[model samples]
Target chain A: MIKKMKIWQLPLMVICLVGFQLYSDVVLAHGERAQQAGIRMRTMYWWDVDVQPTTVKVGDIVTITGKFMPSSFWPEHLASSEVASFMNIGVPGPAFLRMHSYVNGTPMVRSTRFFRGKEYHFKVILKARQTGVPCASCCQC
Target chain B: MGYTDSVKDSDNQSHEDTSRSDVSQDSAISTPEQQRRIFRAFDWMLVPVASILLGGIVVFLVALTVGDWDYWQDWRDRRWWPLVTPVSLMVAPAVFTYFFWKYFRLPIAATSIMMGYMIAAWVSRYANFHLFADFPMAFVSPSNFIGMAIILDSVILLTRSFYLQGFIGAFLFGVVIYPLNWPAAAAFHTPLVWDGYIVTAADLMGFMYIRTAMPEYVRIIEESTLRTFGEAVTPLTAFFAGFLTILNYYLWVWIGSKLAVSRWATKLI
Candidate 1:
C-alpha cells in the first residue's frame, strides 16, 4: 500500500510543477508601476503621445512624438525641474538607439530647465537595433 | 588448569607485541612519502580555492569603490575613469603581493589573483548584464587586466624589493590602464554629429539605453575645463592616476604586512 501511494505522489508533484510554470507571469521589461502612486499622479502629465508605424524591422526608423506638461502642484519634497532636467525615453536596455531627440523644436543633447505648468512638445527619432516589443515612455530626469 | 591458562596468555601477549612492532615499522618507513603526498594534495586543493576567495573579495572592493566607472563603457571617460579604476584595482594586487612574497616567496600572487578575477568578472558580466538584463555583450564587457597584472608580478620578481615594485610596477600599472584599454574604447570616442550636437558613439549609446533609475545628471564624465587641452587630457589623467596608485599601493602593502603577522591563540574557551 505504501509503495502504491509513493508512486502516485510523483505524478501529483509533476502536475503541480507544470501548472505553476504555465500560469506564472514572466517579467520582460522595467517595472514603472513600482513607483509611488503619489509621485506618478503629481509629476509631469503626458498627452498626444504617438509611436508611428507600430511595427518596425531591424534598421528601420521609428518616430515618437509627444507633449507633456509639468504639474503646477508639484511635490514640495521632490527636486524642482527648474534646477536641472533632461528629456529622455525609458526603454529596456538598448533595444532601440535614439537617433535624435528634440524639445519645442530645440535639440535636446543636454539638460534644460523646465518651468512649472509649462507645456512642452517633444519628438524622438529611434533606430531599431534589436527585435523586441519595446515599451517606450517619456521620462524627465 | 591454572598452568595451562598462563601459558596461553603469554603466547597471546607475544603475538600482540610482534603485530604492534610491524605496524610501527611500516609507518616509520612510509611517513615522509605519505606526508609529501598529503602536502601535494593540499596544495592542489587550497591554491584554487584561496585564489577564488581572494578574487571575490577584490571584486567586491572594486564594485564598492569604483562602482559605475568600470561597469559601463560610457563611464570610461578621460578624467575620472582613468584615475579611479587603476587606483581602486591596485588594492588587491598590492595587498596580496606583500603577503605572498613575504611568506611564500612567490611573485605570482598578482597574476594568479587577476586570472581568478577575470574569470569571475567575465562570468558575472555575461550572466547578469547580457543574459539577464538583455544588454549587448560589447556594451557590458569588463576591461582586460591580465597584461597589467603580469607586469606587476614581473616587477616583483625582477626587483625583490617592495619599494622598487611600488615606484615602478604600481606606476606602470596606473599609467598603462588608459593606453591598454584605448584600442577597445577608441571607436566609441570617435566624434559624431547627432542632431547638430557633437557627441561620441558612447555618449549616444548612453543616451539611448535607458537605465531605469539612473539619471543622466548623475553621470560623472569629463565635463570640466580640462577639455580645452583636448588630446592631452588622457595622458595627464594617466600620470596623475599613476601617482595616486603608488600611494595606494604602499598603503595597502603596509596594511597587508600587519595582517600577515603570525600570531595564534594559546587557548579557546
Candidate 2:
C-alpha cells in the first residue's frame, strides 16, 4: 500500500543513501579524444620514452623517464601569454599513486615561467595501488 | 458523494432509502473536526516521498554543476566564473522549485530539496569508487550546499512566500556561498613562488595532476590586469550572481505553482 510514509522514515532513508555511497569506491575517467586536431601534436614533440617493470601487484613503484621539446604554437583563447606553468604527470586514475616527479633536475612542486620553445627532461615515480592494465590520458587542450 | 447521489436518485422506490440517505449525507457533509483529522494525516505523508524525489534531483544537479562543469575550481581562477556560475546554478534550483511547490508545499518541499542535494552530492562522489570507475574521486569531490539550503528553507519557513524566498533567499545564497567555500578553498589558493613566478597551490595542483576528462580548462586567476583597479571584483560578481538567482527564483516559483495541478493534499499516496 502506498499509504502515508512516516516522517521518521526520511531520516532513516537518507542514512541508507549515504551508507550505500560509503561502502564501495572506484574511479572512471576520460581519454584519447581529449585534444583538438594537430594541436598538442604540433606543440609538443615527445621522444626517448622509457618505463621499467610494466607489470606489478598492489603498491609497487615504477619509474618513467621522458623528454619533450615544445613548438611555437599555443592556443589563442586559452593562452594568457608567458604565464607560470608546471610539468604534470598524466595518469589514468587512482589505479596508481604518484609518489614524486622531477623536471630538468628540479622537483616540479612549483610553477615556473616555461618559455614557448624549450626542451624539458622529466622523470616520474608512481606506485601501483590496484592490479590492472596500465592506461594513460593524453592532454592537449 | 457517490453514495448520497445513488441513494437520493436511484433508490427512490427502495424501502431502505431513508436510512441510506441519512448515512451517506452524514459522511459527505463531514464535521469540521473530522475534516481536520483527515488533513492532518495527509500532512504526515509529506516526509518519505518528498525526500526520495528531491534527493534524486539534487544528485543530478550537483553532478552538473560541481563535478562536470568544475564550477568551484573555475571560480577560484576565472574572472567571469563567479558571476556566471550562479546564473548557471540558478537553473536547477529554479526548476526544482516547481516540484517543491506542486506536491510538498513550504517546509517539506524546501527541506527535502536542500537535504537531498547535500546527500546526493556526497553519494555522487562515493559512486566514482564503485560504479564510475577510473575517475579519481579527488577530481570530483563532494560539494557543500548546506549554507544556501539552510538559508533558503529558513526564509520560506518564516515568510511562507516564494516572493520573499526568491528575493531574500537568492540574495543571501549568492552573497554567502563564496565565503562559506573559502575555508576549504583556501588550501588551494596557498601561494607558492616557483622560479620567479607567483602561483597558487591550486593552479600548481591543476597543472601537476592529470584528469583526462579535464585537459585544458579555462583559468584566468589573479594574473589578469583587472586587479589593477583599487578594489577586487569579487564582491561585484557576487552581487551579480544574486541578481541572476532572483530572476531564476521567480521563474521556478511560477513553474512550481503551475505544476501543482493537484490540489488534493493526499494525491501522491
Candidate 3:
C-alpha cells in the first residue's frame, strides 16, 4: 500500500490520520476528566464525595457520603421556601446520578429538607451513563 | 512566434529575463510586511463576522432550552419562570464585549455591541425553535427588539461616545427586551394559580420557583385586552428596562474601555 501511494496524497493521508487520533483523544479525555472531577456531585450542605478511582468502568460503585445534623429550623420552611426556616438541600439545581450524583450510596431524590448544620452521611455507587467530560464545577460523573 | 519574436529582441530580451527571474526569486521569498497586511485585513473583516456569528449562537441556544420549542403545538399554560428567559437581554451586549475584550483584544463599540445582541437574539430564537421547539427559523419569529438593539448600537458606534452608548443602548434594551420575549413567552406568562387560587403572572415570575407543579391552564385574553396591554405595556416596558440597561451598559462599556487601555497581567513563569 505504501509503495502504491502517490506523492501528492501523502500530506492528505497524514492529515486524515492526525484528525482521527485527535478525535479519539478528545473522547477519551472527557471521560477520564469527568471521573477525576466526580467529587463535585457531593453537596456542601449534606454529603461530600471523598474518594474516587482515577478510572472507573461500568457497574463500578463509587462511594458518596453525606453528614446530616439535627433540625434547627421549622419543617414548613424545610418543605417550601414560603413557610420554611431551613435552606433546601436541593439548592445547587437538580442532582445527577453516578455521572452527576450518588447521594448516600444512592441516586438523588427530590425532597426539601436541610438538616440544619446536622451531621448525616451516605455513599454513592458510580454507574456509567453517556460518554463525555463531567464539569467539576457543575456536573461530574 | 510573433509573441516570441518580441520577447527575443536583443536588449529587451535580456531585461525581460532579468524581471522573470526576479519574479521567481520573489515567489520563494515571503515578506513579513505582506504577512502583517494579511493579518490586519483578517482582523478588520473576518473578526467582525465571527463575532456576529458568535452572538447569534448564544441567542439560538437560549431559545432552544428556554422556550421548549418542541411542544409548541400544545401551547399549554406554563408559568413564566419556567421560561426563565432573563428579565432583560441586555446582558448579551455586556457579555459579548467582555468576551471580545478578553479574547480578541478588540474594542466592541456602538453598533457592534448592538450587533452582538441582535445576533445573539436571532441565534437563540433559531436554536429555541429548531432544537427544542422543533421548528425552523422562518416559523420561529424574532422580536423587533433585535432591530432596536442594532439601531441603538449603530447610533452609539456612529457617535463613538460613552453617554449615548450607555443611555441609549440601555434604554433600547429596557424597552425591547421583554416585548421581544413576550410573543413566545405569552404562552407561559399565565397568572400564578398557587394553592388553587389564580395569581398574576407577575407574582410567580418575580418571587416563586415552583419547579415541580404541573401547569394548570393558560389564560386567554380577549382580542381587546391583548391590544390594550400591547399598547400600554410596550412603551412602559421599554422605558423602565431602557433606564436599567443603559446604566448597566455604561458601566460595562467603561469597564471594557479600561480593560483595553490597561496592560495584561503578567506571570513570573
Candidate 4:
C-alpha cells in the first residue's frame, strides 16, 4: 500500500518546493533584483522603459530604453559613480543570457553605474538567446 | 479526503455511518502529546537536510553577488565564484554546530539563523554591486566574509551562555569586519599612478575616462613607491589584521559553544 501523506504535509511540501524555486530564481537574477529583498536601495523607472516593437522574433533588431533612479541616500559603500550606475538585460534562467548593456552610450561589457536620476537607452539585436520566451523585460514584469 | 467517501454515502449507508463516527471520535480525542513528539522527531530528523539546504542557498546567494551577470550566460565562467566560500565557511561551522549540539548537548539554533544573514548579505551584494551596478571587485570575493561567519560559529561552539556569546560575537564581528574584507577591498582602493594619471585598477579597466570632471592635470603624486610591500605601513597593517582574525576566532568559538547548550534542543538518535 502507498504511504499516504497527511493533509497538512502535502500542502507544506508544495509550499517548500515553491519557496525553494523562488529562492533559486532570486539568487539567479543577481543585483537589483536580488538585493531588493533586503534593502531596496534603488528606485527604478519602469514606466520609462521604452521598447521599440514590443513584440519580436529571433534575430530581430529591438531597442530597449530605460532609466534607473537611485534613491537620494545611495549607500557610500558604492565607491565610484561609474560603479554605481548599472544596466542588464537577460531572460530568467537556468541560463542568464545578457543581450546588451551601456554606460552613457558607451558599450558596457562589464557592469557600470549611472547618475541617480539619469536615463539610459540602448538599441540591440535580440537573437533569441533561448526559445519559448517572448522577448521583453516589461512583458515579464 | 477521498472519492470513496462520496460513493459510500450514496450507496453504503452502514459503512458511511461507521466511517463518519470514526472521523468524529478521532477528531474529538486529545492527542497533543503524540503530535508534539511526532513534530519533535521530524525536526531532529530534518536537521541534516535543513543544514544542506542552508548551505546550498548560501552558495546560490554568493554566486549571484560575486559572479558577473554578463558572464552568467558565457560558458567560460569560473566553476566556484560563489559556492566555495559558503562550503568552507558556512558548512564547516554548521557541521560544527550539528556536532556540538548532538555530541556535546548544545543548541545551535541561533548560529543557523545567522546563516540566513550571511545568505542575505551575499544576495544583496550580488544585486547591488555584481549584478545591478558595476563595482570593480573580481569573483565577488565574499570568501573574505567566511572568517566572520566561522568566528561567529566558533563563539557559539565554545561558550555556554547566549549573553556572553552575543556580547563578544558582536564586538569581534565589528572588529574583524574591516580586516577580513581589507585584502580584496584594498585591491579596489589601491591608488595606482597609471600613465601619469592617478587611478585604481577599476579605472584602468575601461571604466569612465572622466578627464574634464576631475581635471587630471591638477592631481600629482610627489612621492612614488613600487616595492612589493609599501614601507613599514604594510607589515603593521597585516599584523593588526591577523591579530583581529585570531581574536574573532576566539569569540566565535565561544558563541558556538553557547548555541550548543540551549534546553530547547531535540534529542539526537
Candidate 5:
C-alpha cells in the first residue's frame, strides 16, 4: 500500500527537528542571559565590576573588584533589608576556593549591612581549584 | 430534462467522484492485525523519542533558568522556598502525565513516568555539567525527583481516582521531597565555622563549590528570620510546599490531558 504520510509528512517532521536543533539557542552561560533594562535602571546598578585575569590556571589566585550602588526606590516585592544582609558574591561552588573577601577596604568574613546609594567597592581573592573554579560571582544580598 | 441541466448534473457527479478518489488515495483503512502492528511500531518509535525530547527540554530549561546550586542552606532559608521553588520543576511531571494517561494508563502509569523522567533528568544534568559548565552533578541532581514521581503516580494507583490524586497525591508529592531529602539537608544543617560567620556545613559547601559564573540577583529568595521553624518542629515549609504541589498537580494533569488529545490520534485510523 502507498504511504502518503511517510512520503511527505515524515520528511517535513525530520526537517523541522533538524532545523530546531540547528537554530536552538547556544547559551555560553547559565541563568537569564539578559536582564530587563527597566530592572537595571530601577534597581541596583554596579557600573564597574572588574575581575583581573579573566582566565586563571588551577591554584592560581585571582581577585574580583566591583562597585555596587543599590537602587533607592527598591521594589517592595524583593526581600526587605530589615533582615540580615550580606556582602556576597556568586560562585560556582567550592571548586573555586575563596581565600578572602574585603569590603570598603576592610577584612570581611560574614554578612554585612549594605547601604543604598552608597558606592562601596568590594574585592575578593579566589584560588582556582583543580576540578572547577566558579568563573562567576554574584551578591547573595 | 433540458440539455444544459443534464450536462451540469454530470459535471457535479464527476467532481464528487474525483474528491472521493483523492480521499481514498491519501490513506486506506487497515485490517485489525495491521492496525495492531502499526500501533506497536508507533509505540516503539514515539515513546523514547517523545520522552527524550520533552524531558530534555523541560529539565534543561528548569536547571538553566531557576536552579539554585552551590547554596542549599541559603535556598532552604527562604520563606516562600517551598511554594516558588517547585514552580518550574513542575513542568516534567505535568508533561509526563500525558504518556501515563494516554498509553500506559492507571496501575502502571506511575512507574513508567518515574523511570522515563529519571532518565530524562539524568541525561540533561550530565550534559549540563560536562558540556556547558563544569559544575558538580550533585548541584543539578534529580535523585529527589524520583520520590515525587512515585507519590504522584501512587496517588492514582492507590486511590483509583483523579480528584483524590489531585488533592492527596499532589500534597504527598510536595511534602515528600523534604523528608526524602532530610538526610541530605541534615548534613547541611550541621553547625560549622566558615570565615567566622558561624555558618552551617551547607554554607561551607557553598563557599567551597565553584560555579563558573553565576549572578547575584539570581540567588534571591525570601530569607525571613521567622521562617526558621525551631529545627523542623512544625514542617511548615513542607506543608506549604505540599499545598503548592497540589495546585501544580491539577495544572499539570490538565495540561497532560490536553496534550493527550492531539491531532495525531485522529490520524491513527
Candidate 6:
C-alpha cells in the first residue's frame, strides 16, 4: 500500500503544476510599491493618468499624460520637492525611448522643484523600440 | 695540576670563540644571486597584492567622490563630468606616484595603479551593472584612464621632478581626460531628432534604460551661460580642471610623503 501511494504522488504533483501554469495570472508590481504605505500615500497624489494608443508596433510613438499634486500632508521626514526632485516614467528595460518630457509645457531636461499643494500637469512622449507589454507609470526622484 | 689545567682552560675558551664566530658568519652570509632571487619572489607576491589593495582603494575613493558622473553615459555632460572625474581620480595616483618615486625611483606608479583601477572598474561595471543590474555595456562602460596615466608616468620619468610632475604631469592628467576619452564618447554625443526634439544618443540610452534613479535627477551641471561657449566648452572645462588638479596633486603628494615616512627602531622600549 505504501509503494502504491508513492507511485501516485509524482503524477499528482505533475498535474498540480500543470494546472497552476494554465490557470494562474501573471501579477506584476512597480518599484514604487516597495515603498512604505505612508510615504506613498502622503508624498504625492497622482490622478488623470492617460496613456494613448496603449498598443504600438516598434518605432510607434506613445503619449503619456498625467497630473499630480504634492500632498499638503507630505511627511516631514521625507525630503521636500524644493530640495531636488524630477518627474520621470517607470518602464520595463529599454522597451521604449523617451523623446520629450515636459511639466506645464516647460521642458524638464533638468531637476526642478515642486511646491506642496500645487498641482502640476506633465506630458511624456515615448517611442517604442522593443515588443513588450510595458506598463508605463509616473515616478518622482 | 697548575700548568696543564691552565693550558686546557685556554684551549676550551678559544674553541668556544671560534664556534660562536662560525655560527654568526653562517647566519649573516648570503650570495648576491640568492638575494636577488629572494627579492624576485617578494616582488612576484607583493606586486599583485599591492596592486589589488591600492586599486580597490582608488575605486572606492572615486565612487564615493564622483561616482554618479562616472557611472552612466548620460551623466557625462559638458561641465561637471569633465571637471570632477579627473580631479577625484588623481588622489590614488598622486599618492602612489610619490611613494614609488621616492622609494624606488620607478616612475611607473601612476601607470600601474591606473591599470589596476581600470581592471577593477571594468570588472565591477560588467559584474555589478551589466550582468547583475541588467544595464547595457554601452551605457555603463567606464572611461579610459590608461592613456592619461601613461602621460603622467612619462612626465615623471623625463623630468624626475615633483614640481614638474605637479605643473606639467598633473595639468596634462586633468586636461587630457576629456580628449583621451573623446573617441569613445563622441558617438554617444551624436545629435538625433526625435519628436521634434533634439536629443543626444546618450540621453536616449538613459531614457531607454529604466533606472530607479530618474533622468531628471541626474547632476549634469552644464549651464546655459556655458552653452554659449559652444564648441569650446569642453576645452574650457578641461583647462579649469587642469588648474584644480595641480592644486590637488600637490596636496596629495604631500600627504603621500608623510605616509611613506620610514623610521628604524634602535630600542624596543
Clash count, one per candidate: 0, 11, 41, 30, 20, 0
Best by TM-score: 1
TM-score of chain A of 1: 0.69
Model 4 agreement with the true structure over A2-92: per-residue lDDT tens digits: 2455776888999999998877632212243434533454444444667677655555555666655555555544333444333345443
Ranked by TM-score, the better of candidates 1 and 3 is 1
How far in Å is the alpha carbon of B227 misplaced in model 5?
A: 9.7
Residues B1-269, candidate 3: write the lDDT tens digits: 22234334533534567876565356632344454565667668976786676556545555554443222222212222212222334555655555454455444533464566466665565675455443434334444445555655565556655576566655655565555556765644454444343434432331122111211112221210111123354555456556666676766666665655435544222
What is model 3's interface RMSD? 16.1
lDDT of 1 by residue, A47-126 (tens): 99999978999999999999998888887756666766677787767778777889999987766778889999999998
Please identify model 1 stretches exceeding 4 Å from their true place. Answer: A1-48, A51-62, A69-84, A112-118, A127-141, B1-41, B213-230, B264-269
Which model scores highest in DockQ? 5
What are the interface RMSDs of all the models? 5.5, 6.5, 16.1, 14.4, 5.8, 6.2
For model 4, residues B26-98, the per-residue Cα lDDT tens digits are 6632244444565567768776566556655655554554333222211111122222222223333443544
Model 2 CA deviation exceeding 4 Å by range:
A1-41, A56-60, A72-86, A110-117, A133-141, B1-46, B68-89, B95-108, B129-141, B181-210, B213-237, B254-269
Candidate 4 chain A lowest-lDDT run of ten: A25-34
lDDT score for residue A69 of model 2: 71
Task: Give the poorly placed runs of model 5, Cα more than 4 Å off.
Answer: A1-57, A60-96, A104-111, A116-123, A130-141, B1-46, B64-66, B69-81, B85-99, B102-104, B108-111, B130-132, B209-230, B262-269
Between prediction 1 and prediction 6, which has the larger TM-score?
A: 1
Question: Where does candidate 1 clash, by residue pair?
Answer: none
Better of 5 and 6 by TM-score: 6
Q: After TM-score superposition, what is the CA distance of residue B82 in candidate 6 from its true location, in Å? A: 1.3
| Deviation of model 2 at B97, angstroms | 4.2
Instruction: Please state the Cα-based DockQ of model 1 relative to the true two-chain complex.
Output: 0.19
Candidate 2 lDDT score at position A41: 60
Candidate 1 residue lDDT tens string, B78-133:
77778888899898898889988997778988888888888888888899988887
Q: What is the lDDT of residue B168 in candidate 2?
A: 95
Q: Arrange candidates by lDDT, highest first: which order?
A: 6, 1, 5, 2, 4, 3
Candidate 3 structure lDDT? 0.43
Report the C-alpha lDDT of model 6 over B151-173, residue by residue, as the tens digit: 88999999999999999999999
Give the runs in model 3 whose Cα sits over 4 Å from its true position. A1-75, A78-141, B1-45, B56-88, B95-144, B178-234, B265-269
